[model samples]
Target: MSPIFMTLLLIVTLGVFAYTANRRWRLLMVGAADKRSDRVGDRVRATIEYAFAQKRMRRYPLAGIAHQVIFLGFLVLAIRSLILFSRGYVEDSSLILFAPHTVIGDVYSLLKDVFVVLVMLGTLVFFYYRLVVKLARMTLSTEGAIILGIIFVMMVADVVYDGAWINLRARAAGAEVTFSGWEPVGSVLALLFQDAGDGVLRCLAHVGFWTHTSLVLVFLNLLPRSKHFHVITAVPNVFLQNLTPRGRIAPIEDIEGKVEREETLGIKRIDQFSWKSILDFYTCTECGRCSDHCPATNTGKKLSPKHLTIDLRNFLYQHETALINPSRDRKGADAENAEYAKDLVDGVIDPEVLWACTSCRACETECPVFITYVDKIVDMRRYLVQERGEFPNELQTAFRSLETSMNPWGFSQDERGQWADGLNVPLISEKPDAEILFWVGCAPSFDERAKITTRATAQLLQRAGVEFAILGPEEQCTGDFARRAGNEFLFQTLAEANCGVLNGYNVKKIITTCPHCFNTLAHEYPDFGGNFEVIHHTEFLARLVREGKLVPKNRVERTIAFHDSCYLGRYNDVYDAPRDVLRAIPGVKLVEPEQTRDRGLCCGAGGAQMFKEEEPGDERVNHMRTEQLLATKPDAIASACPFCIRMLSDGLGDKERTDVEPLDVADVLLRSVEENVPAEQTAGA
Candidate 1:
């Protein structure tokens, strides 16, 4: 074959592949703008700092190093391949001609060979870690494994072909090229090829080269059709990811004050998801990052966020043709279109998996591709709760209670202020013009264990001379639990009622000790015209201490570990404020568990899981969290969320570990101040 002809053919082949791949990519990414607005500069900075730089990955040293090396090696090898192809066949030119075999080309070729070996080894290690060693519970479907294996084979074949070709060409020209200076493994192969007959060596070179090229082409074509589509979708998903409040639910607006009777509130089918969500499904690498971190999954519940995405993707692909041609009848279609409505309900997801999530956002936090698993799960919940009216028995009763009493526990709305009978708490209705409206959440107003936190917070506010008033009996449930449980209608009812009452009072700033209340009031209420500045009690206390309004004199000489609540820490990014409040007390040493900040494990209390019983599992989520906290062996375990406080306290009580007390962040702050500082100083400071 003529060298010039071969060069042109290769160029044409590459151009065809690139064009097809890019066209499909453009189509899939068409409506991404409506789902999420792009901030190019911020994304570029994050990509370089967090993704490519592996800043997040580096926290896990061994795995991080392995991944970083493989990623960087792929880039190096890609450039080397382009250089080799251009010099060997296409545009046959070399810088070495100026100096007649300069050392640079040889050095570049050697380094390329070395990196190829490194990449192959790294991939092999990952394969064993995922499959053989089973260090983690990795998802290895047949399709996924086949795609990975083909990519690995291509890497090996490319290096072998290059080495073999170099040896054959040198032999054909009757030049004695030393193999000793070449890369370790490739040098040995080159030496072996030197003694082979020219005819046999040339044939082997062609076979190796063709095999490498063919595999690359096959991989390219299969990418969009396989789970490996993440290779293309992952980067774009990361770039266009939601940067808004993670704790907040997306608002569903009433179109012209006319609710569409047939319209779905959350995702009922795959098509109903925002295009970004569809991209999220395609971009999941099935790395099990979410599964590993999920409280439900870790505790042996059926909900694996990674598997949820996989199932949704599989269902979409299975019905792709029918979905693309809606007018045409298919095997599963009913003559009267009866089966069309039942397709998603029966096909895409199991009822158990859909209901098992705690809406903890732990999955989304751990996912390297930035998949929004919580949003998708919540959407599915909305379908089941709003449209189908299907839910756990406990949740159904809770919904009824919320409808009647404006609380989930069936307590009388008039008696909601019973917990504050002896305490000096003011009602916002009476003191409607108060500076701060204390939104005492459902649990604290009712639950016995949580009431103490509320009273302490109120007393602390009074001591700080901060004028605050409560909604009293007029306050309704924030409906966070209902919304997270998938009752969008109920959520909207509760949100609108609460927004109306607050608006009537002209409330400007609100404060709450409950993380759930803080999240709902700060994030979701704005959707219903409740635009108050909301602060969690820990954040408020931290600020108070910083301003010298609250002073701590005594040092509690005990190791205290702070548990990051899912809503407060992962959902709202309020990890530091609670810790700051605790650390401000002299002699209080703060110890941290292994999972903190972005990777914090859930207490399994959010998503209305607190109201419903946990599914049968080897370990309870609270027990797992308690064990982690116990490992720190602190004198006390502190938390900001009432649900977390209750769960952890019960877990410890069950374990009969009375020595390690579970205290609300406010209680701990109060105790530390009570012991260290004189009452006069604490009151007047």
Candidate 2:
């Protein structure tokens, strides 16, 4: 009767689980193609480290530790769950090699008991977090609470079942057994049922056994329907993470073929999202870590990365049948006007939410499972900009400026060399023999504040006796802003044009003061067949300092907080080079912001935010970042990116603290280098 009953239950539970899983798999298959299976070894290693090891969770120590315990407990308990299931069919529940009373079984039983307690404690910690301490970073959902309750009950049920079995066995033998192999928790619990009647003992054992087995099935079915579905999808999601440099948005291939194929230039509908993106939506744990660290969300913007994933995931499910069953649609015109005909941007996600993103990758960095947020946001932006011609009006001026002059500021290309006028900077045309092409990015070329950084970098390069030439009148914006702002066509045009010019020059290597330009030229331009060695000015300067070609002399003493530009640090993993440059200088006490390096906040200038008016928010992103640097009370702030310098300077101005100067790493190094230079050499020729 027991074997028959358990088999029927198992079949029913497994059938439901398979049905739900198949539905999600079909939904995933409906998405556009994305190659996530390349590099098998790397994917497996990433899965082990990120998914199994829970590497990212360690950022929050207590929560991380608690999760580790719970995770391990689940893995360990899975075997025990199997054993318990088998006990319903067979007399003995232990594995074939390790039966009750054996050394292996005894050791396994002991470990299982220890973990059972630890798992309960782990759940208790979360209960305190949710119900008592109430951490704001965690999403408080009844679903989450109920899941917790279910886990707690599962543990209790397992304990009760074990204890009741022990009690019944001892009673049947008419003896008091001491320290049995599988009875650590059971022994302790058995004492309570020892004096109970035979009928009561049997009832307790039956109830406990049924509850534990039934709840396992309940939890299995709960996945794919709740945020907890991460347990099923997270490992696969982490394995499939984009392996390219984080900043490299895949270029649109065959941009001109859209008219003939009736294909939208960018993602216009849910079906256009990549399979990996759909996996990302399904894998989200709803931990709220992404939104917690997101500058946009923290400062009152409508973009919460967590909620964005949730919204998209919900929409994916809401139209799952509509998306997966295209064949079921009516014939003729109704086929074209399918069930999921509603627009996604304004229909599902608000425009305010879309434009508020800074593309900082903070959310991606914080996500434990490596789910990307920027790619999705940018893809949708591409749709709005290219297909619908519906985006923020401020972007129009930027697009117009970029279209006509190849710079967002509408500055004449003739003035690109003006910053280095006194220094007699060589143009690539005039000095085609130069080794390095100094790519003076748009801000450095046009923005007043950034021009100083450009000049400082130029002076340092000259002082170091390195032969570098600028593009001068031929230089164009790298189209970083346009691309990030969703104007991919403009970016592609600019990239191809710049590649042609660079190829004409036969340039081998390039250096830039802007992280944006460096990232674009180094990572994104390669897609346009413009592959060339590119380095950030900070890194080049750091290398020069290390090689003893450029020495920082004289104590231009000041405490400076080094701001990590998102493009340089997170996008390209170039964090230490800029700091190493600052550290090379004598009498420069380098301080770090509360938010620094991979965890650094954005300056409201990235994602083309500098080119457009900031979305409505309580506090500006740059000002918030400036405040973090200001909290250190440094003499000045030092940054590598020209954009960062401008944003931080503007932030300091807004706060009326001009005394806290914003200086580039190059500027600080230049101050020390020039102090020892001959006054005549520094002066005009």
Candidate 3:
């Protein structure tokens, strides 16, 4: 090895990499500041689980296994690369501890050879995916193939260098090249060249050494310029992932101040996004796992989470010089750098793409690097709704209805407690000292079909001797729908009013049948000073049954397929409670749909889609989810969320599957709990 040439190679390649990385860093800083440095312990644990352990990648078995091997191989072979670099300066350098004859070195040599072979096999797996099988879910570009080729060649070159070096050493000692247990792969390779001359062997060693080392440096520089940038940013991205409750959307702070200051309401321009979001763009692996699982994408909607991130990232990189310029941040830069000031909604991303999202979090769930979609989509929608007054005509109506009547449907707030009229349910105003307040959501209070679930839940609580009271007319919409639909002003007004009411009553605990209400109250309300213990009815019922407070004695003979609400299952991780309630009923067999629990398909009702028509798609999301549940061949489809019940009921009707019933868990539980009661006396009946 030539020290002068190697030193020159190191200086030039390392210098180029440093410059490229610094440019990326500067671009990242161009976005607004974010707080990701807090909670060091939690960040470390997540980095270990999702990054080092490669937890989320394992969701797709073959690809996960292949990636794990390649990732671990890179880590193990990192030392080998460093050792190779050091040997350029000191020909016999093993850094003392890894000298060939020592036990520590022997073990490492064996591990290194094993991973070299494993790494090659791993590359072949991806080769099959990219070339042979030609998976549509991944970015099968020539660059991907080239990177894989570099890795494969790097492994081969390393083996060649080891084999030639072993042979050269034996020849120098005038001894035969004998196989050593510590160097199994290299020993085996050396046998192939044992018959070659010393000059040829030296030539082979030089070629192998130079090719491997040079290609390693080249690969290092290629990373920042390609999607392989994830190779550098993925771990940090995971470490800095949003650690707040998954269900809670970060609210816009100081809304009036921002409005008065004429600051952008939401993400009008790409630079308005926080740096963590910019990192999200950079760290996207383009693996399409997010899109594959996304309800909007699967249903042939305009939004593909992968492509959305990619489009923004491309726009960022396309205007990197202007965006990173300090002049761009100064006044009047908008006129000078008009391209950089372009609205992200219709310029970089189609408005329809943002509108189609269900906010089900499927994309976020499937993302191996923890890139988020809902927040970004909602932020863009905020710009559309608040800043530009350009949202779907339907959302405008919903917003007005919410503003006037405190519900999306414009139902009179005075009748909010009518659903519990005959169930002996008391209002919190009448019994202000009640232990828990039932937060009857808009759907349950106003929609006729959803009222049945509301009644059933109330009757069950009464039968269990749980002293719970309702908010009655004092309750307002939780603003989950408004916030998600990008009406931040309306959402904040509703949230503040609702919080004031609840706080006035000194409400400590709440029970709600709507997953949306439960989620907003428990996770989102704390941000507005409305902290309370919110429990979904199914969870409360499950606990009552567990504590021997509510016994299900009557036999409700039915095979039920429980449909998971995305808010309940994916957002809040409340999968088991509903299932537990269903299982407790005698003669009721609980079955599961293929896409149940966290992977459950959206009912197409979240993100305020319930109040508006779904964006055009190949199929309605709820219809697709209904077909999945129907595949289980259940006597009934049971769910806990009022919105889910309503959408699924419509799904059943649309499919003309009237023979199958769509009942809420409370509806089914009421049938069993009210033993020997007349059928018409039951809440559902």
Candidate 4:
């Protein structure tokens, strides 16, 4: 064959291979669109700014810079290789800028050489981190390490070929290429190549060039088939994130009727997941960021959100052929199918891992790629409860209570008003025309510690002159526990009943001290067509202070650490209002824990974990949070959610350290007001 024909044939063969590989990758990635809505413009911008420009990576400055350099090097090297391929074999002198003399070509060669060295060093550092240093709780599986080695080898070979080719060409032209300033390595290699025949050097160049190109193409083809698919999916996931209310789960519009349908309520199989959920599986970088922040994982629980996603992905991949081609039967087919059936008791996911999650959203918050781990977990819980009739044994009683009496504790519905027995609080049923209804949640009315918070809130409301009436015996549990525990059916029943009661009355607004109650009433109730303006006591009190309805008369001089409740803080984004209330109290200096707001650790009370026993783990979630709070060394620890108050209080009690007191936000405000109430005229008696 003529040299010209050989060059054309090589170009055509490589081009076809590249196109075919890329097309397959696109086909695999196309399935990621179902869960997430399209925001193409936003995706493009985020991809450029974040994925390509390394915005999020920059948060870890040293590693970020190293990655950015390597990324840029890959881009530059790719362009240089294309230029070399076009010129070397095709006799395309027009593409060879360094043929005779071009300062720009020299500059290009110099910079390319510099970047190749930088890229090599960067890759080495990354390898160490992935396999040795192991930052972000990262570990390299055997396959991962092998892939890394292949990529490293490909890069080194490419750089070596470029240097050798440049040197050979320079010597052929009898041009004494300066070695001191630029292309030092290439200049040395060129001297060695002078002795080798032209044909021999050309053959070596072709071998090196083809090897690099082939490896790069193979890497591209393997990407979507491997964990490295995150490279393409992560950017889009981050950009198209659900920027809506975190506490507000997508409610079932016709909850009762839908359950009667044959359609699945939540994910029962891999294909049952929304495309976004599938994308989440594909987009995970395996960096273990979620596991690093997981309270359950840190506590030695079997539940690692990271591992949960990983396991699901592996299961899906293993069954992909069976799933796509139903006729194809293989060994263990029935067992594998049963394992992915979404019913927790029989599913691959352990009951412990499912229940262990506190729904803290820490995993969601820390996931750099914006994987909504909490949502997926919640969806699985929905499936478990709605279809499979599975849940923790402790939750059985609560579920029964909620079904029978409309409360988790099985308390008499009439007793809901007992929390206000001695107080001047009016019953809303007696005053059906009342403007505001005080929602005294089950915890406050039934649980002793939480009752104090309820009383304090009532007094605060009275002092602020906010007209509010209690539902008394008419109020049932808001069904927050039942819903979170995965009994969506029970939650819907209670919600419909509660909505019916509220619908009968003329309640324009509702307020509650419990974050769980507040969240459910405010966000979830609307799904049941029971829409009312709702506010947490912390928010209401803060507004009262701001409006000058409640004046801060006394200075409570104590340093207090604020424990952000998972439901109030992460679920509802109510972080500021609680802190604002504390800061408004004169002499009450608010000290924040290291992980405050979105990063705040769970107190292990959400997701019905409060009702059930905690799973075995290295550390209790609440203990971990309490220790962090104690690190602040505050006189008191305050929280807005009653559940958080209960858990943190229990944690503090376990430590046997009485110096740090745990108080609800309401307790703090009420105590401040009581302190300012002067010893009323002693002579009056």
Candidate 5:
């Protein structure tokens, strides 16, 4: 390649790359203010682990190895790209080259040859996935194939370039000499060209060199324009990941003021997302791991989280000029705004798609790049529910019931303690000095199917000799469903009300039968100025058993398969406590459904799915999860959440597995405990 042409190519390619990259930076600037740099130490560690080490990618073995090879190859080949560029400027870029005879350079040459082959091998694996295996979890695109093809060619060109150079150097010395040992892969290839004329070998050298060098620039400029942009953004995106508790939803700040100002309640436009979210969109690898695990997607719903992010990202990129250029929409409102806004609610994202999410966090958990989907979906829902009043009609009833009765069932709050009427459960109003306040959630209080679990929990607490009282009429819904459904206003009202009641009673500890209530009180309530030591009934029972406060001496003798509720297991990390409680019971053997713990499927009741009809799907999420559990062939299924129990029990009836009962952990414990109470004590005169 000529020096003048090479130099011009370098200048032009760098100029194009810089211009396109700067355009992305300004587009990111259009997003809402977000602070991600606070925890610098954790950020760096995460970047090195998830980005440098490719931690999450390892979940899929074949793809993991292939990706790691390509990632490491890029890091090593980056130096080679730089060295080639420098050669275009200087006659002998000896400092940059690993040309023969120098000790360090010779070692580098051998290593480069080995990596060239390794990288090409890695490319073949991905090519197999793209062209042959065609994994459904991955997006198939011509652009992806083109990028992989270019990378494959680059690796081959590097080795071929060295092979051609080896032949040229040997012939220049006027000897039929064997190739040097330092060029392992290249030396092997050079032998084939030993009989070739000098002119042919020289032509091969120019072709290999120009092909390798020119393609580097072409690939560089193409990166920001494709999903392959993750090559540059994934590391930074990992570093900027949200560090909040996994179970907590970031609260809406200054809700009253935002309402008064008539500002966008949620994400009314693409620009309303935080810059970190924009990075999330850019960092998606087009790997559908999120949607693969997503209950909504698995059950044939219209919500594919990967496609959602890509759609929003493409929309933002397409309207970059109006968003980044202040002169176009300076006042944040212009007649041209219609072209810019595009109504994020129903225009960019469908209403059915927004409502379809179970908020199981399966999408978030499976995302190798840490791209979040729940927050984005909820944000869109917030806009539709609060600003536009255009959510699914069923949600309107749930919201109305929440506002009036403080429960979705619209039952009398006074009857909350009726489930434990025979168990002597005291109302918090009557026994405010009790050790722990038992928050009998709406489901357990109002839903007849859930009251059995509620009664069992109260009885177990009593058997443990743990002084506890029910909030009864004073207790309200924890707002977990409302908030997740995108009605932030209703959620906030309920949160503030619950917080006020708890604070007024000077409550310091609470035990909940419902994971939804436990998650909200322990994680979400603190944001509303209500902080307490909250425990799920399973955790409470496990602690009591550990302390010898309760003893399970009777042998129920049932092979039990444990169902992990997404909220209890994935959201709150309470997986072990429930299992431990089940394990401690004598003659109780615990079996696991294939998808348990972090990978547990949603029970289909999360994200306010409990309050409305499921969006169109081939199979109910609960039914799918139930089938997986029943495959274990347990005599009974034990769960720690009311929602899980409800869903699984319903599934049992549907599948005619009524012989396989779904029992709450509390129910199992109550049945297992011996006759510890004296007759007079039980009478409680």
Candidate 6:
């Protein structure tokens, strides 16, 4: 081996990598500051679970196992790479403890040999995926092929070098070469070279050694320039993942003050994204797993989470110098950089792309690196709605209604409690010291079908004898849609006013039938000084049944397929409560849809899509979801959220499957408790 050439190769490649890494660091710093350093123990545990264990990757079994094999192989072969590097400068490649024939050395060599074979197998799997299978979800780039080729070739060279080294040593010792368990792969390969002359063996050894070493350096330099950069950033990104409640959108602090200062309200510019978000951009593996599970992308919407991240990353890289330059004027930059600084909504990202998202968290749930799309999508929407006043025209009417009537549909605020009129449900104003406050959300208060659920929930609570009262007219929209749709000002106004009322009543606990309201109240309301123990109504009802406070005496024989609300299931992980309540009812067989629980399809009512028309797609998300639930061939479809009920009911109507009733979990449970009473009669019974 030539030490001089090896040192020079290391110097050139390492020096280039250093320069590239420095530029990437500067570009990352261009983003706004984000705090992710807190919660040390939790972060380390998460890194170990998600990054090291490759937990989420297991969702795709074949690819998950293949990627994991390669990852573990890299860890095992790392020492072998270091040994080769040391061999360039020294006579003996191994350090003192790891010298060949020693127990530690033999163990290390055995592990290295195994991983060499495994790594090749792993690369072959990816080669199959990229070249043979040509998975639609993956980015089939030439760069990806080249990287895989480098890896496969590198593993081959390592084993060849080992084989050549073993043969030379055996010849020098005047011993016959044979298979050995310690260096199984190398010894088997050595048998092939035993008859070759020393000259040829030496040449092959040098070829293998140099190729593996040089490729290692070459691969290092390629990382920062390619999507393969995730190899370097994924671990840190997983560790620094947002620790806030999954459902809560971080509020725009001091919105009015920022307006007075004329600062960008949300992510108007690329650099407005936080450093963590920039790291997310860097960590994207382009595996397309996020977009694969995305309801919008699945339905052929313009928003592919994978492409969105890649586009932003490409933009950042393309204008790195301008963005990182402290002295450069963004507005006065060269034409290309000036264009790069333009609003991302229409320039880099289409507004339709933003509008198509359901805020379902499907992408976030599937991202192995914990790269979040919902928050970023909502942040950009904030700038469009609040600053530019450019959003879906339908949102204007919804926003106006929310502003005028404390509800998105402009239902009279005074009529909010009318849904519970026949059920004898008390208002918080009438029973301020009630044990729990039922926060009946906007849809339940106004929508006709949703009112049935509201009445059923009230009747259940009345039967259970749980001391609970409704906010009724005192309640306002929890602003879940407003915040998600990017009207932070309106959300905050409503959130504050509601908090004042709840605080005045000294409300310590809350139960809501709407998943959106449950999520907002349980997670987001804390930002508005409204901290209370929030529980979804299904959860409360389940607890009541568990405690024997309410019993399902009648057999309402039906096959019920339960649809999980994204806000409840993905956001809060409340999959079991509704199912438990459903299971408790006699003669009701609870079945799950093909896509259930965390992987459930969205009902297409979230992110203000209930108010605005869906962004054009091949099919409506709700229709697709409804079809999934219908595939179970159940007599009824059950869901806990009012929005989900409304959407699924519409989906049922669209399919002319009106005979298959769309019932709320409460609606179904109340029938059993009330001895199979008709829903209309249950309220008065």
Clash pairs for candidate 3: none
Q: Which stretches of candidate 2 lie over 4 Å from their true place?
A: 167-176, 180-183, 190-199, 330-332, 676-685
Q: Compared with the true structure, what per-residue lDDT tens digits does model 2 show for residues 83-104?
A: 8889788745676745767888
Ranking by lDDT: 6, 3, 2, 5, 1, 4
Candidate 1 C-alpha error for residue 222, in Å = 3.3
Each candidate structure's TM-score, on Cα atoms with residue i matched to residue i, is 0.86, 0.95, 0.98, 0.82, 0.93, 0.97
Give the RMSD in angstroms, all C-alphas superposed, for model 3: 1.5
Residue 285 C-alpha lDDT in model 5: 88
Q: After superposition, how far is residue 187 of candidate 3 from its true place, in Å?
A: 1.6
Q: 1-685 in candidate 5: lDDT tens per residue?
A: 4789897898899999999999999988888998887889998999899889999888889889889988988988888887777766663464644655788788887777778878888999999998999999898999999999999999888777767777877777876657667778888878877787878887887788888999999999999999999999988999999888778888889989998997888888888899889999888988999989999999999999988988998898888887888875745557335576768766888888888899899888888889988888888888888888887778888888889999987777777667787777888889989989998899988777678778777887877788988788888898999999999989999999999999999999998889889888988899999999998989889999999998888786889999888888888888899998889999888999898888988889889988889999899988998899999989988888888888888888888886787888887787778454332221100
Better of 4 and 5 by lDDT: 5
Task: For candidate 2, give the lDDT of residue 139.
Answer: 84
**Tens-digit per-residue lDDT, 1-685, candidate 3:** 8899999999999999999899899999988888888899999999999998999988888889899999999998889999888888887788778888899899999999999999999999999999999988899899999999999999999999999999998888898988888889999889888998889998988989999999999999999999999989999999999999999989999999999998888899888999999999999888998998899999999999999999999999998887776665535535535787788888889898998998999889889999999999999999999989998898888888888999888889888888877678888889999999999999999988888888888888999999989888888899999999999889999999999999999999999999999999999999999999999999999999999888998998899999989999899999999999999999999999898788888888998888777888899999999999999999889999888888998999999998788889988888888877554443321
Worst 10 residues of 6 by lDDT: 676-685
Candidate 1 lDDT over residue span 220-319, tens digit each: 6677766677766666777777777888877556722434566665666555666677687778777787888888889888788888888877765554
Quantify all predictions' global Cα lDDT against the true fold.
Answer: 0.76, 0.86, 0.90, 0.75, 0.85, 0.90
Residue 518 error for model 5, in Å? 1.9
Candidate 6 lDDT (Cα, 0 to 1) = 0.90
Worst 10 residues of 3 by lDDT: 676-685
Inter-residue clash pairs, candidate 2: none
- What is candidate 5's CA lDDT for residue 121? 86
Pick by lDDT: 1 or 5, better one: 5
In candidate 2, how many Å is residue 348 off? 0.7
What is the lDDT, from 0 to 100, of the residue 468 in candidate 3?
89
Give the per-residue lDDT digits (tens) of candidate 4, residues 105-153.
6777677777877877777877888777867577477656666776677
Clashes of each: 1, 0, 0, 6, 0, 0
- Between candidates 4 and 6, the one scoring higher on lDDT is 6
The whole-model C-alpha lDDT of candidate 3 against the native structure comes to: 0.90
What is the alpha-carbon RMSD of candidate 2 to the true structure? 2.7
